[model samples]
Target chain A: MTERASFREYHQNIIERVATRLEESLPAQWQIPSSLREAMLYSLMAGGKRMRPLLVMAACEALDGNADAALDAACAVEMVHTYSLIHDDLPAMDNDDYRRGKLTNHKVFGEAAAILAGDALLTHAFYLVARLSQVHGVPAEQVVNITMDLAELAGPKGMVGGQAADMEGEQGLTELSQLEYIHLHKTSDLITFSLLAGGRIAGADEQKLEALRTFGQKLGLAFQIQDDILDIVGDEAKLGKKTQSDMKQEKVTYPYFIGLEASRGEVERLTAEAKSAVIEAGLADPSRLLEIADYLMNRDH
Target chain B: MTERASFREYHQNIIERVATRLEESLPAQWQIPSSLREAMLYSLMAGGKRMRPLLVMAACEALDGNADAALDAACAVEMVHTYSLIHDDLPAMDNDDYRRGKLTNHKVFGEAAAILAGDALLTHAFYLVARLSQVHGVPAEQVVNITMDLAELAGPKGMVGGQAADMEGEQGLTELSQLEYIHLHKTSDLITFSLLAGGRIAGADEQKLEALRTFGQKLGLAFQIQDDILDIVGDEAKLGKKTQSDMKQEKVTYPYFIGLEASRGEVERLTAEAKSAVIEAGLADPSRLLEIADYLMNRDH
Candidate 1:
């Protein structure tokens, strides 16, 4: 198969596996309250691009590691991602009524259930990571390291810190540096974490891991800039939400800071930089990673 | 010194150490946004009884383990506890304006900041546990175990599950069994986790760990019962919040179903049972655990 066709097949396969695992992630034995479980599953199963989990698996496979070993971590990252979305959509936060084209968690389940669901998803993410050692026989030391890294990336100085800065910026932040800082933590940190975590699970050396970090940083910026571009000129039906939300919220964006054409150029530049990083990493296979980068650059939604 | 006086001294000493550690927990190097940092520290350092951290240390000491070894885990449990309180007091949840006689997190920092602060705190708890292996040289296997246990107890099936049930119960839950389920998961689970985690840190064997679990469950129930009694009869000045607020909210407390005298009796019964379990555990010293049981049984706030 051609590289694009192979990448598509692999992506489809992983998405199916991830969806199944996520459905079964919260075991019945856990006896999570029925309503709470529903709320968590509602948003979790609503389905996004599953980009983070895919990154984890692709990174692991590129290292010649068994992709199955990274499955739990893949699900874990997605859970964290979903929880953030749910909380961000809360009335007190984004106050959005829709996400991924459906009613937001709070809109469907009420604010209280939505909050608990988000909290549960975040807490459960760690539980899944801890299970890596017990279930997959990944080394305890590696599991601990991943746990620590996940917390740092997702915690205050990482994603949470980025989010906090983003909210503060809503009060009229103008500096390009400030905007970059917000995106770096809020958006890019978690993306970097997915790559690094997958590499760690595969026992990649520091050099390879650093390469993955660089790749993730570049790709994340490109991905986010594309999002901004889409918000301004993309089809609303394809994007699955209202367009011009950034303008409505009076939120700053790359397209706003630099014009749309300049923003698009930045995406290409970053994606090219990201592809080079993976190529330098000298993985057993880098075709998939390279293709994913290219695909992200061209996607409309 | 008499047992009471020495117990008092030990309690005071641990509280001081815990307070200092919590103050320094979020290192300056993390570069957390100033406002988010302030919001997290506001709730974390506001100080309650520090009961959870004390339980961790006391359990470790009782096992003849170095209490110092359990210090990080101690701080971790408190962080989780504090985060829960912050989220629970949000406008969509209990709508409380005050916690521990201070303005609630959302009240002081706005709903968005409060939500993000709580998320950061919860994520950071796992970070602390993972640090146990790196910082204190706790065995990686042991750290992994503690991480799993903490997540389970604090996640959907444990504390979060309890909180969800409690919120659901607010719509006229009358069953005594439902109340017990809420208390068991919400309050008792974390208490049990604190003891078990401390035991694991001290390298307690399974039998001893089981005893700690039993001790914790009983103590946790007794503690919640006392909280119920105090809500109706507590001195607001000492309690640091309004008395009878539970009644005003129409919350289903132990006394609400069993009457004040019966609830008091249950606390005594549970405390006695808890003390017996610790005695049976054959620890290096059970004096502190026994004293704590008594303290909980008699505390007015």
Candidate 2:
């Protein structure tokens, strides 16, 4: 009956809804070749926090937009995020054996399948948006803008560019600005896009959109810094994969540039900034956005 | 001038124009990491026939649409084609060492950069389409539809799905229908999309659109079968990569399922069908499309 508990319930409900919708929306396995379908589904359905989709839905709700309208966009963002994870875990990239407490996609379905699956998902993201326009009767014009935004934020100037920076930076000493660039594009760009996409779908005004963008940027940075802290000091079982792997690979991280204590402080600062942006922007029932940021900052994994 | 000679000149002009535009449009190397940009440009700008972009431009022109309106789309299709080649040549895929008379992208840029470069190109394809909508003042709605069509044809339902089937089929004796499926999707989907995308941009009517689709499918199949024939009988210097490698890998091909002469016959049959479809559909100047089919059928490489 408490207000905070009700918001918590609302967040959890959206997470479950997103998970189910993602499963439902994917191309039917029998229609495509079984192996390819399985590969895409395996990585996609593998249990994760569903944080990106949750962000999408929350932003949609905050703008008093139809949650149903936001569903496909939420799933689309998740697909993009999941595809990135699959590619980033490939032997040629991070070469990780596990992800989200399960065998990495390439480990489960050969590297070729994994790569193709990632391609399929990335491609499907656009297709789904098109389907959204058709099925939901959203203006084709709005969908075009949404599609462009997603592509721009996830392309060279955004996530892919960041990924390239991260891969190249693996060999060099980590600089703060360089690390920021990597994190901003590789991690935060997609996350920021997810929130903005949700807001856009909901018809948020420019001022509200600006607030969502600011919240997304700060929260994404905070979330990534928390990931860095987890890599250094968190329990292995809770984290799913091995700890100290960033150190093992000599990958750049917040902990590498700043001490553990300072990194933790930065997360707190970013989380606070994210919350204030939501409040300043006067989002309806700001509780959910604020709660999500707090949860991201404090998550153990 | 003879019809063949004039057609050859037309094709040559488009190729040169496409190459210049592709080079001019790509993200400058300095803006992104040099290695990643270099790897992408290596495969992308490397000499090929510029077939996909040429198809797009020709389709647009046939519809009496402004050629300038189709340039970004033409470049976008080529980028997609180039990215597929880059990933397909990786150690995990076809494992080819040379492409278009040059060392493969991975050979020059290392596996990580090649993979990342492929990713960037794929992501950038959409970005370019979005930019097309913005820069050319194309209707956002049309662009969304175009984006969807491209994504659908190139996603699991089309190219990526075909690739998965191809990869999975590497272990088994390839069936005839299975081979057709692979060809239709893996090789033809993008080609089909390219032609259709150009037509769509040109405001082609439904009848013309259907004609373009049929023409694309037949021509794509014919083109791929020619590749199979060339792999068996092509001179290595002309083909740019080692010939007869399909047999070495035990990969299935048109030549593998049908006799060499029969495969050649099929190419002729498909080319005739492609040309007739264009003519029957009442396109303006179907000569260019008809001629392109003949060129594909006869090309040594």
Candidate 3:
């Protein structure tokens, strides 16, 4: 099979496995109050690309860590990612009703359930990480490091910082630096974590991690720009979310502030940079990452 | 010193010690983004009653773990508690201006920073626990168990669940069950965690942990009722937060659903229950806990 098709299958398979593992790992404590449980499950179980976990698994595999051991880290990242999405959609935040082709968590579960679900997912992410960190095979300290990396990335000054800036910027933002700040933390930090974590779990050294970080940073920026382009040129029906949210919110996007053609060129440049970073990581198999990068460059959703 | 006076001293001293030590253990990455660092520092430095951290110390002491070693756990719990407060005060949430007689984090730092600060605190909580579990002197697995306890308590199924219920209930709550859920998760979970984590760190046997849990549960319930009473009966200026938040939101509280006399009576009952549970745990210095229970029964804020 071609690299692109193989990458897609690898990505899909890992995500599915992580999702399955996550459901199985949830204990009775998670089952408390059915409505709350439903909310947590709804958002997490709602299908998406599961890109974060894929990065984790792929990175781990590349570095030589057992994929099974990395499963918790993989799932944890997704859980954190899902939790952020649920909260970001809250009335106080982005306030959306649809994501990934389904009614948002709040729409189906009510605001309370949605909030509880988000909280659950966030907490569960840690629980899974802690459990995996001490699994019989992996050294406990290393697992701790991986989980800590995730906690930091998903937290303030990283993904959350980006979010707050993104929201606040909508009111009155003109500077490029502020906009860059938003995307770097908000958009790219988690993706960077995804790649680093995958490599770290698999035992990638600092040199490899640095290369992957470069790759991720470029991919994330390009991915976001493409997001901007999609909002303008892509179909909302397929996107499953409001196509015009950025415009409606008056938020800064590459296309809105920097011009569409320039944004497209940036994406192209970023993709190329990302490809180089992957190749430089010196993995025997850069085929998967190369394909994934190209697909991100070309994807509609 | 009187029993109440002594525990107050105990709570104050250890919380400060834990807080100081925790500052040193903070993730190095926090220093990267100046804006993010400033926001986190602003709220964290504001400080509070330090009730959660105290519980961790107390629990650890009770279970035979050195309170000093468990200091990080105490700090972690407090961070989680503080973060919840930050988010709880957003414009779409309670929209409060002060906490502990100071400007609330969001009010002082703006909504964006407030959100990031809260997220940072939550994320930092786990990072601290993960680090704590790996401390040089402690048994790694024991530390692991305590960290796990901390994780579940801070997470969705626990404290976050309660917050979600509170937010949803604010719009127009109809049932007492909903109020109970909110109190249990939002008001009590962390407190219970605090007490339980302290004990867990000390390697408290299941029986001892159960006793501490029972004490924390009653204490937590009483604490929420006390908050209800304070909202209705305490001076606004003294409370630091808007006294009328629950009332303005039209949500049920101990005062709203039950009369003042009943709420007062419940507080006394729960405090006594908490005292008895701690007594059952058989502290070598049971005096400290006895002091806290008395204070919980009668505190004004």
Candidate 4:
């Protein structure tokens, strides 16, 4: 096989693994109300790039950790990501009718179910991490630490805080720094969580974990800037929603503050910084992490 | 002071402690967005009976556990309870303009802020529990257990599931069993979490934990039935809500199925059974729990 074909297969393998685990993440034996279960699964099973989960597994793999052991953490990050998307699409929030090329949770299940589903997903993500000790024999201290980090990164001062700022910015974004704050917390915090969690699962030291955090932060910002660029210049069908929806909603983005060319340059700079952080950390294997960083930088969607 | 006055003082002490902790619970050092923090604290500090946090402390005390050690768990349970109230009062949910004698969260903060505030509270609740190990020196294993229980009891198959069923039931009247299911999950699960968490914090064994579970299930159901009863006969001034509002909403309740007299009798019966379980467990001191049960039973609003 060609070198590119081999890389494609490696990436595809991780995606399939994450997808299957996520599909099976919700407990079937528990008496989950049918409609609630359906609403949660509908948006969860709806395919996205699975970017957050992929970052988790890749970070773990870079540490020469067992990717299988990191699978639950991988899925947990995605669950948080999915819940955010569901809530972000609520009528009270963005009121988007579609996500990942499919109808948004509230659009399909109505607002109440949508709200509950988002809540359930967020709650369940913590449950998965807590189970890591019992299921994967991760140390109790590590589990506690991982759980704490997940909550912090996703909680009020992190992703949710970012979301609140984003909504406030909707009225009128005053400065570039305000827009960056929204992206960092709303988008970057959880991505940072994915990498740090994977590193924790792999028993990486504090210094290595710090590296992962920096890498995740830079990469997340780059990915988000690329999203803004795509919104203005990309194809609608491939992008899964209407292009220029951000402009229509009057949402201020990176490209809005800085021109498209500057935004693209920012993505490239951030991706390079992200890869450099991982490489300097001297992980067991950094090839996959570096490759993923480059892939995120150039992705059309 | 008279015996009644002393009892009032005792309850007041616990409430004051929990209220102070909750007021300080949001990490001031963290970069929580100002408006989001205000929205969260608004609903949280809006006083209720403090029933759930009281249960956590009371149950911990019953097992000779240091109430101080259990405070974080107590605050965490109240956070979950408060978040549920915020979301339940949303425009898409109960659509209430008032809660606890003040404007509801969505009414005060707008729908988007209310939703994000609720999300922040829920996520923060887990963060608090995860900190128990660090703050109180609770064993990591116990912290893991508490975190897992908190998620399961509060997640889809528990409180959120019951909420979904309750919303579905709004479409039409349902059988008594369906109402019971909703009551058990929506009302009972988090209460059960409080007791079990307290027991775990106190280092209680499995048998005592089971006793707490049974006690919580019975007491929680009784509490909900009492709520339904109050909806009909309650004084609006004391209740801080409209009397017969359940009827206005066409909500099916225990009184709607069984007569008011029968519902009152059921509450008494359940309270007795709940106290019996705790008494049979031979806890360090069951008096507080027993008193709390009776207080819940006789509460007018």
Candidate RMSDs in Å, in order, are: 1.7, 2.2, 4.4, 1.9
lDDT of 4 by residue, A52-72 (tens): 888888888888876776999
Residue-level lDDT tens digits of model 1 in B201-264: 9999999999999999999988998999999999999998899988898888999998999999
Query: Please, what's the RMSD in Å of model 4?
Result: 1.9
lDDT (tens digit, per residue) of candidate 3 on B80-115 = 887888877777566677778878876777765666
**Of the pair 1 and 3, which is ahead by DockQ?**
1
Ten-residue stretch with the least lDDT total in model 4 chain B:
B1-10
Give stretches of model 4 more than 4 Å off: A1-5, B1-5
lDDT of each residue in A1-301, candidate 1, tens digit only: 3545577788898888999999999997877889999999998899888999999998998898767878889999999999999999998889999888899999999999999999999999999999999999889999999999899999999999999999999999888889888888888999999998899899999999999999988898889889989999999999999899999989899988989999999999999999999998889888878988988999888
Candidate 1 differs from the real structure by a C-alpha RMSD in angstroms, to one decimal, of 1.7
- Candidate 3: tens digits of C-alpha lDDT, residues A1-301: 3544556577777777977977876676552556666688788888788877777776777666688877877788888888888888776567777788788887887654665576677777777776765674565656666666776677765787678667667777788777777788777888888888778767777888888889878888888889989998888777877677778877778787789999999999999999998787788576667877898899998
Per-residue alpha-carbon lDDT of candidate 4 for residues B79-169, written as tens digits (9 for 90 to 100):
9999999999997899999987999999989999999999999999999999998989999999999999999999998999999989988
Give TM-score values for chain A, per-prediction: 0.97, 0.95, 0.93, 0.97
How many angstroms is residue A226 displaced in model 3 relative to the true structure, after the best TM-score fit? Answer: 3.1
Interface RMSD of each candidate, angstroms, one decimal: 0.6, 1.7, 3.1, 0.6
A104 Cα displacement, candidate 3 (Å): 3.8
Better of 3 and 4 by DockQ: 4
